[model samples]
Target: MRPTRAGTIQDAVARCYRAAGGVEAVAEQLGLANSTVSYGTEINEARPGGIGVNHLARLAMTDPDCALPLAEFFAALAGGVYQPVGGVAEVISLFSGCGLMAKECGEAQAATILAATTQRPKDIAEAEREIEEAIAALTKSRAVLTSLQSGAA
Candidate 1:
C-alpha cells in the first residue's frame, strides 16, 4: 500500500524540528529543555510521543507551516487528510477545483473499466496510477466540502 503524504510521525516530527531549525533551535524557540526536543525528534522504530500538545501549540504559534505535516500525520490515522484553507480565497478555489475533480473522476472510471479484465502488467500499472490521481482529486474535493460543512472557509 502507498504511504500517506504525512509519512510516519518520526518523519513529521523530524520535519517540524528541521523547519524550526533543528533540535537545539527548536528547543530554544519553544522554551523547552534541550533534552525534551532531543527526545521529541529522536528517530526510532517505536511510536512517537515525546512531544506534548502544548509544546506543539507553542511551536505552531510561531511557525504554523511547520506543524501542518504533523497535523496531516494524525489526520491520516483517522482516514482523513488536512489542507490549509485560507478563508475566502481558498473557498473560491475549492469551488473552481470541483470542476477539475469531476474530470479526474471520469478519467479514473474509464481507466478502471479499461483495466478491469486486463491481465497485462503495464495496463494494470497505468490504471493504478490513474486511480491514484483520481483518488487524490476526490480527497481534495472532500476536504473542501468538509471545510464548508464546518464553516471553516
Candidate 2:
C-alpha cells in the first residue's frame, strides 16, 4: 500500500534536506534555523508542524530546482498527485493522463465484448458512458487548472 500524504511529505522533507546536504545545509539554503529544518524533517504521522506554510513557500520560491518537487510534495499532502516535469508541476498533464485511461477503458470494454462475455449491449453502453463521464471530468479538471494557472480560478 502507498504511504499516506503525511508520510510522503515527511519523506520529501528528509529527501530535500539530504539533497541540500544536511539539515544545517538545507537550513542555510532555505534561510531558516537549523532547529526548524531539523524538526520539519523528522519522521512523523502528522505534518511537520515546525515547517510553516510560509517557510515552505519561501523554499519553493527561492529554489528554482526544488520548485516543482516542492509543489508535488504539497499536492501529496493535500491528497493529490501532481508529478513534476522539467522542474515544473504538471498539473494539467494529470487531466490528460486520466483522459487517456478513460479512453483505454472504453476501448477495452469493446474488445472484451467481442472476445468472450455475452454481455448485453446496454451493459457495454453503460460502461462506455461511464468512461465518457470520466473523460468529461478530466475536461472539467483541466479547465479548472487552466483557470488557476491563469490566476482566474
Candidate 3:
C-alpha cells in the first residue's frame, strides 16, 4: 500500500493509543501525565501534531508492538524509509530474506549477462528460480511492511 506521509505519525500514535487502550491507559502504563501522553496529537485528524522523541521512546518501551509502526510513521514524516530495529525477530527475518533474495537475483542476472556475452546457452531454469525467489522475497517484504504499517504485528 502507498502510505501517505500526511498524518502518518499521528495515525501511528493513535494506533498506539488504541493498543494501550486509550490515552489514559497509555499514560498510566508509561508513567506519564495524561496530558503529556495525549499532547500534540489528534488521533482523528488526517494530519496531526508530532510527538517528541522522548514520548515516542516511552511509548515504545511501554508497548513493544507499537514500536515499529511508530518509527515507520515518523520516518515517513521525515521523508525517509524507516529501518526496523532488532526488537521484532520476525521483521528481522523478513528483511534478511529480502536481502538474500536480492543477492540471488543479482547473481542470476549476472549469469544471464555472462551467457549473453559468451554466446552460451542461457540458464533459463536458474533464471526462473531466481525470478521466483525474488518475487517471494518481495511478497514477504510487502507483507511485513503492511503488518508494520497497520501495527498488527
Candidate 4:
C-alpha cells in the first residue's frame, strides 16, 4: 500500500533526497548548493526549479529509490507497469526491492539503447552488464513473489 513515490515526480525527488540521506549529503555528493538540493526535494508546489533532468539523472544514479517513482510514472504514461525488485542488498535500489528492480531494468534499457546507437564495444559491454544485473534483479523479485504466493515467504 505504500509505493509512495509512484504518484508524483515531486514525491520521487523527495524520496531520492531521503534515499541520499538528506539535502546536505546529496548537496555534498552532487556539488549542488544546499538550497538547490532543498528546493528540489521539497514536496511543495510553490518552489520553482525543481531538479533539472540532467541533475535528476545524476542524483538518481547516486541511489536506486531516487529513480523508481520517476520510472513508474513514465511506465504508467506509456501504458505499462513497473515491477520492482526485492530489497536484499546494502546500498541497493528503490524502496529497496521493487525500486531496485525497476532501476536496474531502466538502466539496462538505456545501456542497450546507447549500444545500439553508438555501436561501441565499451557501450556494448556496459549494456551486457546492465542486462545481467537487470535479469538477476527481476529473477530475485519473481522468486520472492512466487514465495509469497505459495505462502513460503
List the candidates ranked by lDDT, beginning with the highest.
4, 1, 3, 2
- lDDT by residue for model 2 over 1-153, one digit each (tens)? 112245456556665555556677768877878877887755554754347667766766766555555667778778986632321133356567577557766765675565446567866666666656555555455665666799874
What are the TM-scores, per candidate, against the unseen true structure? Answer: 0.62, 0.45, 0.45, 0.45
The segments of candidate 1 whose C-alpha lies over 4 angstroms from its true place after superposition are: 1-11, 42-48, 80-98, 119-125, 139-153
Residue-level lDDT tens digits of model 3 in 1-153:
112345556667767677667778877877778876776354435435445667767877977776867777777778975643333444466658678668877876876666556664456555656666555556566766777789967
lDDT at residue 140 of model 2 (Cα atoms): 57
Root-mean-square deviation of Cα positions for candidate 4 versus the true structure, in angstroms = 15.9
lDDT of 4 by residue, 1-153 (tens): 113344576666667777777778878988989888777745556753376778878877867777776677668879976766454343243247688788999999999999999999999999999998988777676766666689766
Model 3 gets an lDDT of 0.65
Report the backbone clash tally of model 1. Answer: 0
Residue-pair clashes per candidate, as listed?
0, 0, 0, 9
On lDDT, the stronger of 2 and 4 is: 4
CA lDDT scores, all candidates in order: 0.71, 0.61, 0.65, 0.73
Poorest lDDT segment (10 consecutive residues) of candidate 4: 86-95
Model 3, C-alpha of 24: deviation from truth (Å): 1.8
